[model samples]
Target chain A: MKIETKVEKFTEPLHLESGRILEEFELIYETYGELNEDKSNVIVICHALAGSHHVAGRYADEAKPGWWDKFIGDGKTIDTTKYFVICSNNLGSTFGSTNPLSIDPSTKKEYRLKFPVLAISDVVKAQMRLYDRLGIKNAFAVIGGSMGGMQTLCYAIEHPTFAKHYLAMATTAYTRPWAIAINKLAIESIRHDPIFKNGFYKKDDLEASGLPGLAIGRMAGLIAYLSPGLFNRKFGRDYASTDGLYELFGRFEVEKYLEYNAYSFPKIFDPLSYLYICKTMNIFDAGRNKDKLADSFDKVQGKLHLISFSDDMLFFPEEMEEIRDIMIELGKEKQVTYKMIDSKCGHDSFLVEVEKFKDYVSEILKD
Target chain B: MKIETKVEKFTEPLHLESGRILEEFELIYETYGELNEDKSNVIVICHALAGSHHVAGRYADEAKPGWWDKFIGDGKTIDTTKYFVICSNNLGSTFGSTNPLSIDPSTKKEYRLKFPVLAISDVVKAQMRLYDRLGIKNAFAVIGGSMGGMQTLCYAIEHPTFAKHYLAMATTAYTRPWAIAINKLAIESIRHDPIFKNGFYKKDDLEASGLPGLAIGRMAGLIAYLSPGLFNRKFGRDYASTDGLYELFGRFEVEKYLEYNAYSFPKIFDPLSYLYICKTMNIFDAGRNKDKLADSFDKVQGKLHLISFSDDMLFFPEEMEEIRDIMIELGKEKQVTYKMIDSKCGHDSFLVEVEKFKDYVSEILKD
Candidate 1:
């Protein structure tokens, strides 16, 4: 299947949860399948950090399918043939979205660090605006994992009737302290890059001198996303002779794997956008102003399907249990269901363990 | 009690496990209590990464006591009244020891990156040379935690009769892949600092510009050294409004704590030394060059006391179990004992939860 990205411009001034306003912004999105006459068959798919509008299918010039290609194609778990899937790039991401790389109309220059700080709710609001523009009054479901899951939860709470089903995978209603510490490390890594220059460096210079810091941040994040069991099983004491001398810098395969992924990340991702997104993630609290999590969930009328991986160290299963227990205590047990996927892939299980959840997802998406 | 550092110079070249050699080096150490006439009452205490010779007691001009002062004073756990204690700065650290910051006699300049890459065995060997200089043929016990524990294990395995008792705390006989990954991040953080300039920058410039990277590295390492329960209990989402406005960079108490420690680290630590030490840690495998761990322990003759924290994520109790199980399989279980310290302090429990283990230490050290 082939897909193309489309842009929707919201010219009206938009207010952000951070109390900052954007005069105008554009959302980049891709759609699959046909929308029903009532526009009620639309499923909004939110992307995680580093993900983009391309959730499934390949573009004409692209060699690879979308990030969620396995689960969203025809006859797949999401079954694009049965539902219209709309995946949009979140705000503060560099993937053709209104992010730090986007130009500021007033300054006629890239926003860079001047870009408004965003909350997960802001990203959800932008998607809701896109839905309104596309005549999607009610979505069949809102589904995502990690940062994407944050958006799904936000949509379910803020717009109770906007979706019939909400699926959150390998994520939490609020960022925990440990996760916040990891995010802080990543943000500091980018900020400490000498060429970052307080996020004011020229794009080329930033990419040049800032890539190492970005790579280091990604490496650190990757460690959190993986389980020790998986790493040991995959690369236990296996040495790679880097210089043919079998000496210092001769690395274990897992270390090489992390370094490779981290080094490659800067080629496609912007460090400033990464910092902003991580900051937004760090402040994610579903019940920020509410008295408790139960109160926050009171407005979420959509049936909730919470999925967590057993080996996920970043968003542990205990975190998912916290949300489930809160819902149970609020007498919302009938409206919520929790599932734990037993896998050694850790937090990345949401992306890699699709086969493990294909049947459960299909059952939940059924009419 | 007031204590001071004493240096021991080894003019003979030291050979490292990495096939590198140091022409000459010095060990900065501190001692408490008097050596017995037979030189059989010495207890060698190894310091962890970032730890120094000041294991106990305060210096005359200092406000704070040694890092492990609570556990190593006159009548503390490793009581100085009964056993003469010697704590030496490990190779590849910067605390007045021969390290990357030390001068090369031939070059008349700091060794910097020119310092030989070292292993735990190399550090143990250096300490053994110090013992030879002091005319101590055998030690009553070799005790340490974390990297210090690694040294204790090395001393036991490499010099079978050098110590009568070996206590390894919150550490492993081999560095796990996950640990290597974390260490890699720390090493890369230091190397990526542009001011590091491949470890050739002027000392002042390196300290000023490279401190952020060093701090970031420390922050990352600190995360592993703590448990989530401790963070939740200690700094649970309490926000600090910097600049009198809750905005971007407004931090949680935990973030501030990590940042403060990270920022303060460079004032006393060297990035090159950090990298070298982390590299050494990454290669710490007691079974290295041996077909199996049992083969490595074949020569070990000391009575073993293995201690692990229940909540230590870095060196999990499972890791300690692995070593204990290996000893059991080799019929050395009678010579070994294991203890789990139930604490929320994680890897730092060995240092902070001294009260929990004072009696245990005293019992084990008693003749």
Candidate 2:
């Protein structure tokens, strides 16, 4: 636990829906940009999986802009100079934000597995608090990528007054059976891990599921991050280098990179945070409304832009078309438009393949 | 551990450049075509990773052809009526071949990790025995795809007298750094798995490194097998379902397809065999016969047709040009030709992109 006592929380006593009372829930967040005098020029930027409120500015160090650092800089997509951009590290974030890893206050111990299951609404509610605190009556835009996109869609429906412009990037409204299987396998790798000790073990157990599970989980996530061709280009069948010809036993260089990356992740991310985030993704159902997503879209009063990657396997383009179709059926087609960017990098291409992503971002934010 | 008591050894201790002794080895092979009366028309059809000897015949429930069933059938690439075709599983294989998991006469238990690393030469030697069994005095051609291509190059260099025509299809003479990296990661996944127990564990330990390692390993290999854009085009972040709901649960159809494929891989592959095959590829070097590759007209005694894909990240078109330069330098450009096929499917396209793989095969065979 790298302590960040600076975190503040607001409790929402209970929001009953899924049969369990999410009682006295403490939600945490962080922000960027200044609130305009009118507070109407607000742009809420949602973070994707492993994202946080620290989208811009320093978080103790010379923090590089956010993960979307390139898109949300000065005079860029979410130009801070023209708009008040508000971002939050969702309630279940592993960042300094409140999460399952946070102390329960009642027990004075970390929540761990005892934390209540969270829905996307929980995160939406958390942001609502920040909106209430800042006295913001409406948002200029609510933009996000991947899981952040899910939030953008949810916010537009759950609280239409908050977002006038909605941008969902590389996101799906719900988890697919295939995606769930991979997540399940990853979670199994963690839970069945010998070190997990049924999630009751002390935090120091590295040999257990924490590192290995995080490593495997990240690997699975990492696979989703890039295109198959990119990996093949980066690492072909070349073996690790050897100083001497006689060295028979040696690894290839690419192997070293994954190992190093997987090893470091466990330290930075909590197992419980991963669980909550995945659960949030799994439980997301915008179509649960009476008319399903069509009704959900009917409630939203915003210009919806659904941008997807041609190479994103995690959220295939077909599903996005489904979302677009539903919105269009609800007479939201003019407000809802979709574009597919071509790239060989798969899901992560939005974050990588910078020039392509940059062009799209600029086009969307163009005056 | 599916017992096949009929496995036979080649009855020769293969001598390799590396002093490591592979006590004895065997060849798992299938044959097609007929040898010419002069024994001058023998063609060796090499198979890639995860391929087998049942190239074109009915082997139990697997009806289709063997690995290259179409390319070497009645009127295929190496037409049986015109040449003798031999497809042999590599020495360190698990497909009804002498592999690491086979029972070690010395220890009584399956050799598992104790199996000595085998090389491309070992695969060649095993094939040579099958050739000798069929009394092949000279070969008309040696052909393969991907890993099979690596073997084709190795066979050409080691026994110049055996292969006079080399049709190297979408293969690299040497495994590049990228391929090695991906494979190393796959291997590392297995080696780090405690269930593997450093390559040996109780037979009952079904949930060991082999499952996840093999699953991820094979899936990782898929990076080389398909184009990034194709996956994206088919799946791009489409939600996991056709329903307009967003429940943070489950996966998409394409993911389910991949899982279905990966599920069968662990059962069919041996962890140590995967490790050893990589070692063979790592030691692989086609630079040994630079003169022959460079000057197809000079010292070279065989006809060369090197084919590559424009979108292939593993074996780039630039590499095919490298092979072409050698032929051009030797003034054997006419004897050695090269072509880059346009495709959206990556490396594995050579196998599934039949019309393309077949056209090249037919063209090469005709000349």
Candidate 3:
């Protein structure tokens, strides 16, 4: 399927969880298939930190299909042919959304760090506004993974009667110390970059000199994205260059891979957006009331599916199990389903190892 | 067990595996208790990255004891009262021994990147030289962990009859892609630092402005050092400061912990030495020849004990298991032993969770 992104402008002020405000904003989104007469077959896809509205199909000149093209599209697991699928570039993301890179109306300059620190719930609220403008009352499902999964849980809790099903993959009910530590390293890397200029560096300047620190941060993130087993099997102890072993700055095959992907990231991503998105993830707490995690599920009116990968170091299966256990204790076990996918792809299993989750998704969405 | 580091100067040039030469060097070491008449009860301890020769006891003005003081003392696990314990600073380490910070006699300047990329065996050979100068032919055991473990294996392999027991803890047979990827991030962080000045920055300047990039790199290293389970239980999702949750650059309890430790690292350690040591670790392969891992063990003349932590993300149990499997296939299983310690401290379990391994160590060394 071919895809085209559409933008919607919202003039209303968005009051964030932290009491910060986004005076006005725009939401860029893409839709697959067609909305049913009553819009009962709507499926909202919440994108992860780096993901955007382009969830399926390709643009006219694009080389690769959308990020989740395999899992979406016609007759696929998500089955966009039968259900209208809508994916929006998150509010704090750099992907065509009114993010830190967007010009501020008041100062007529880039928002940069002036952009309000967003919560996962704030992004969900923005998506909710988009749905309101699109004349949708309720949706069949809200599905996402990682940070997207966090948004899914926030949406389900904040709007208990919206979606019929909430499928959160490889996520946690709250940000833990382990995940926060990783996020800290990434944010610290960007903060340490000389060219970052306290998040005020010109985009062109960053592109030319390169955000080497950001690239390094990306390398750290990439390491956590996949499992050690996969890395050992794929790259092993191979040297990228013949004389790498003999040189102090020698490039291992894995180093080369990380560098290529990491360096390329700065060109497409804004450091401020990356930082803000990471903070949003760092502060994401579905059950903000610490001791009332079970109470948060009391009013849930949808089937909550918590899917996790066995080897996901970022969001361990045990985290999802904790959430499942909480729901079970709350007498909502019937409404909550926890599935652990035996995968060797770590956190990215939701993206790269979709084949393992395809049949599960197909079974769940059969109706 | 009062410890004082002693420096030994070597006038003879040392040949390195990378075909580079150290015109002359020094080995700094610390000894505890007395050496037996025949020198048969001597135990040589190999220190890990960032570790030092002072492995036990306290110095005159020291606030804390040595890194492994808990494991080695008058009546401790290693039993310094009965056996003489010697811990030597590795060749490329920042602590006392000849390193990148040391002046190159030829140019009369710090070696910096000019320091040869050392193989683990090169360090073992230097220790061998240290042993030769000390008039020691063999020892009771050679014990180490992490990078030190690599040295233990290299020493055991290179000098087959050097020690009766080779105890290598929480290390890999060779550096894999997962490890190389992590090292790349750390190395990239230092290289990306604007203040790094291509490894020619004045030491005073680095100390003044601080190596923010190095600190960031240290944060990454620190994250890999401990298990996620420990982080969850220790730091949880608590905020370091009351206003942290509301601010974009807010600090979580975990972030604060990482920042405190990571930022402090640059004050004590040199970035150049870290780079060289990381390179050493990346290139460490017990068997450099492909498909000859087993062959590298052919001349083994001592009992090899490979100890691993169950949750060590840096070096997994499977890695040690692979080595044990190789020994078993070669009918040398009787000579090689593999022990897995159940601990939540990850790779640092060898240093932090000593109680769990104390009985095992005591039992093995009873003879």
Q: Name the top DockQ candidate.
A: 3
Candidates 1 onward: DockQ, in order? 0.63, 0.18, 0.85
Residues B178-267 of candidate 2: C-alpha lDDT, one tens digit per residue: 566556546656665677787776556754334556665676566556754566566654545664223323445455556667656777
Best by TM-score: 3
List the candidate 3 regions with Cα displacement exceeding 4 Å.
Answer: none
Residue ranges of candidate 1 with Cα displaced over 4 Å: A207-210, A242-246, B1-4, B106-108, B207-210, B242-246
lDDT of 1 by residue, A1-367 (tens): 3355799899988899878898899999998888888887788898888789898888679898888998897888887787899998888888887998788999999887788889888888888888888877898899999999988889888988988999999999988889889888888898888777888766777555346778888888899988888898988877776451225556778878988899888888888889888888888999888988879988879898899999998888988888889889888898788999998888988988899998999897686
Error of 2 at B352 (Å): 4.9
lDDT of 3 at B76: 94
lDDT, candidate 3, A1-367, per-residue tens: 4355799999999998888788899999999988999999899999888888899998779999889988999888888778899999999888888999898888998888888889888999999999999999999999999998998898788898999999999999888888888888779898878788898786778766367767777788898888898898889888888988888888988888898999998878888888999999998887785467777767688989889999898999998999889888888878888899999889999998899999998777665
Tens digits of per-residue lDDT for model 3, B89-174? 89988888999989999999888878888889888888888888878889999999999899988877888899999999999889
Q: Which wins on DockQ, candidate 1 or candidate 2?
A: 1
Query: Sorted on lDDT, highest at the top, how do the candidates line up?
Result: 3, 1, 2
lDDT of 3 at B339: 88
